[model samples]
Target: MMKSIIDILIYAHDGRGLGHVSRSVAIGLAVRRLFPHLSVLLVTGCGATAELIGEGELDWIKLPSYKTKISCGKSCGDLGPSNIDDKVLGTVRAESLSDLVDVYKPKVILADHTPQGKHKELLRAVEGSTDSKWVLGVRAVVGDVDKVWSELSADTFTSRYSDILWYGDSSVTGSSELDKLSKHFQKIPFETGYVSRFKELRNIVTDVCTHKKLAGVVSIPWSGEGTSVLLEKVAEVLGGFDISEGIWKVYMNHRDPRVCGVKKSFECHPNVYLEQLGPSFLTDLANSRSAIIYGGYNSLTDVMGAGVPSVVLLRGMKDGEQEEHAAILSKSSSAIVNVFPEDEVTVEALRNSLEKCLKTKVEPSNMVLNGAANAARYLAELAGVRDANG
Candidate 1:
């Protein structure tokens, strides 16, 4: 690591789910790995950032956060969309961003999801930066583009950002929302197949003995940052399972088992071996006989990378990004079984998938999971950075 030539500031407005924050973390990790001299600063509202991003990194700024109204129907936990005023909130966030920009003087500013942020704050904050590269990172499907266009308008698209970074595969499939925004796209888009933190597994496809070794893993899926609407439902369905004979580990992400089932404590859940999240919890999923997990961006790649035969959950609704990813991955390989909620949750599919994953030995797919590294190297190029040798 030589003299620091650039500093990268990533603004991840986690008004939605951990998806945006997680994706940004993957990119930041990649950036730090590629440009060891470049310091990465991430600004986020996700409460789990401190716990997930590691301590003493001294790289994150926590902000007063709010969650999307769509995700949280009635119960607005702590802070929700109804609790916020766009005008006042925007002004407050803009001031904080502007102050940070003046001091940090970032060489590259990457704004995830919204260019205007939760309330048009990013547009107002980066007004005076003459040397910084402004970039907008977007997912494949970002909801009704017409609604987005009406909210942001055509005027907001011109000269607001330097590049459009798309983190989805353009050839195999496409995002309807991104397709609609294509006419407004001006700059060259840097598209990555998908941004995943883990590299694709090589040759560790040994089968987990199900009958011989009685063990399983369950995780409640979350759709947004503030609350786990999906988790609450899944937990209830899982509570009825009679797995007392086997050891079951559950990652109750945002759901309380008491609210759903799990009458006993973690220590007394009889069959449930573990139900708490830890620093290296994914390792447990990677080493499981079979597992049930969410279909989020990172979760999909991480489990697939782990080469564990698993069951993926879907909300079975429109504008759900995970559904598409689940469809693609499930089709690409037979390692994962996709399950959806019908009328209510169809847990039978989960049970069947678990039985199949546990009893069978499947070959590992050769799909590449190097998107994080690719994104890191590409962002370095976007910053127009060159090493001393170059």
Candidate 2:
């Protein structure tokens, strides 16, 4: 028998972008920090893991890449990204994963989002391997309720899992969504609220001073892969607003760096203040009058976590994840507004949404910022590792 050598193993698959991989890294970091002695391993598809997470801090396995396509779960779109043919790469990936689970024998397995993984790759391995307890971690809002509910109802493994973790706040997801999930799992999964990787603004005093300087500056952070049109339209429409210093603040990130190329930058008539990719974005999000962001898991969490007034625009594709999250954001707090029709997002709608976002209410509870640590603690408990920090 291959003995247990790893404490926890995470499968972070991504066909589209970085949200799943990012959250998985945050969890792994939290688990490693919370329980320093136990080794943590993450199996991820995002190539940027090394860039986001420091190398060698945790054991890692990178699967071959696959491009992700956005499809409305209930619609007639093509099924997501193509997988490596099972005969060759798929067989190796599956066998390699199964071998790892069998040989390393991790004490816990945390699967983010999908229970089966891309193309059901982890199904056999997860079911047949080790004495390892299984955990399914889901965000508060996962696309459309009907779509997500239907998918869950059809899944055999979700009902059989040892632990299911919901990383969004209970209030945001509400009883209706919870009730829907409870039917499939037969038990309500643990709700950890919204998880944030932030710890206050770097320096509240200095940050306040910066925000005062850019009194009219609005922050726009977006997923590079999907929101090119929305980004361009917003940039074009900034002409209507009175930018405080003739400088607009936009964040630079991996998926989309130059949101508007230099040509569009000049056309906007304001010196576009693009924050470098590496600087912590929370401070920028905090300093802005408001943020206009895509409704991806991390973006919503960050916006809500920072307690920033903002507008949530949804791609609503690929299972309606962002669409679901945007709806929840609207329901939970007045500060975050969801603007629809991402394809035709206009200056007027954005202007109207941003105005409302600026005056929206604070989070009804602290659940918005509670996810990362709570998840870490739960993972530790599942491993049966005594909480030495207590």
Candidate 3:
């Protein structure tokens, strides 16, 4: 008789960014592929993220959306609505998650990034489950360590959590930083490379017949206030640079219909095209001559992996991880140009950066990792679905 594999539940606090949802879905898909018989559940806060994942082999539970922010440049935490009380919001989050936990009865719960999802009720559910395993899935990059440590320390769920899984390459953080953190808790630090949901579909390249040069402008999903200001600045710079001769494609990852108005304002130029978000998003990226983008680890990695040079606009007053990431990549002889939030992203500055990138032939191959397969393998091992050793 065949044995049944344990079920796994992956939690994602999507809120306003695509990074959490995108990474979580990749893990779910990988786990499913590795253990076809294993049951997988994806709990997400973003409806767009759920829709993006669709009704695939894995089951999904959509949680009520919550707003999050980086406090004091070091920690990420939830913010209460202006009119609503903290207790009210917390109650709502907890109740919604508690109901789902009772209905699903997941065997193992894997949380991505956020610790207080479902208003900390999800943690209680997992702790109450006698047979369930609990794991926290974290990315290679994180906000201020001090703030995160304080937040985690204060939460009751931190002690009850089973293991901490670092999703990116461990080498990036160095031995000293890892040692300091490891002293505090049982850290199951594993580098499954970068969790990317990039599918290599038919490569369809769009032809540009114009004699002028074209550049691609990619923006983070409309959530951060700084990102919006940056977009406007980019538009202003492009307009001044006679960029109309060249095409500019404003790329949005959320694919939210509400963004249409914003895209029209930023990308609606004689030479600009507003491309909505979709699975084929990266394909368009691959075909672009150059890219200007916000600093998200996965997206930045993908752009570099494609061997395309980029101008990384570091979101100011945000998490320092992105700046650190860009800084690390920048050491490679113009692999990436790091621009601060306060820096004027003028047309001349952008034009100069693009020119330098076009002239330089630095190949950023060292950063690329065979992440998807490794991540899948890791999930398989965790689920105890791997074949017996010889």
Deviation from native of the Cα of residue 345 in model 3, angstroms: 3.1
> For model 1, how does the per-residue alpha-carbon lDDT over 34-131 read when each residue is reduced to its tens digit?
67777788997776676455422337888767654343223133444346664566678788888777777777788887667666677666666667
Q: What TM-score against the true fold does each predicted structure earn?
A: 0.78, 0.79, 0.79
Evaluated at residue 298, the lDDT of candidate 2 is 73
User: Sorted on TM-score, highest at the top, how do the candidates line up?
Assistant: 2, 3, 1
What lDDT would candidate 2 get against the real structure? 0.63
lDDT of 3: 0.58
- Model 3 Cα shift for residue 332 (angstroms): 5.4
**Cα lDDT of all candidates, in order?**
0.61, 0.63, 0.58
Residue by residue across 216-326, what tens digits does model 3's lDDT show? 546455445444555566666555545544566676643443454355465445666666565545655665556777677667665665556677776554556777766
Separately for all candidates shown, the number of backbone clashes (residues 3 or more apart, or on different chains) is: 0, 6, 1
- Best-first order by lDDT: 2, 1, 3
Per-residue CA lDDT of candidate 2, range 280-364, in tens?
Answer: 4555666655677666777777666666777766665656667666776677665576557577677688877766655565665
RMSD of each: 5.4, 4.6, 5.0
Worst 10-residue lDDT window, candidate 3: 200-209
List where candidate 2 sits over 4 angstroms from the true fold: 54-59, 71-89, 144-160, 199-226, 239-246, 252-268, 275-279, 355-364, 387-390
Candidate 1 accuracy as lDDT: 0.61
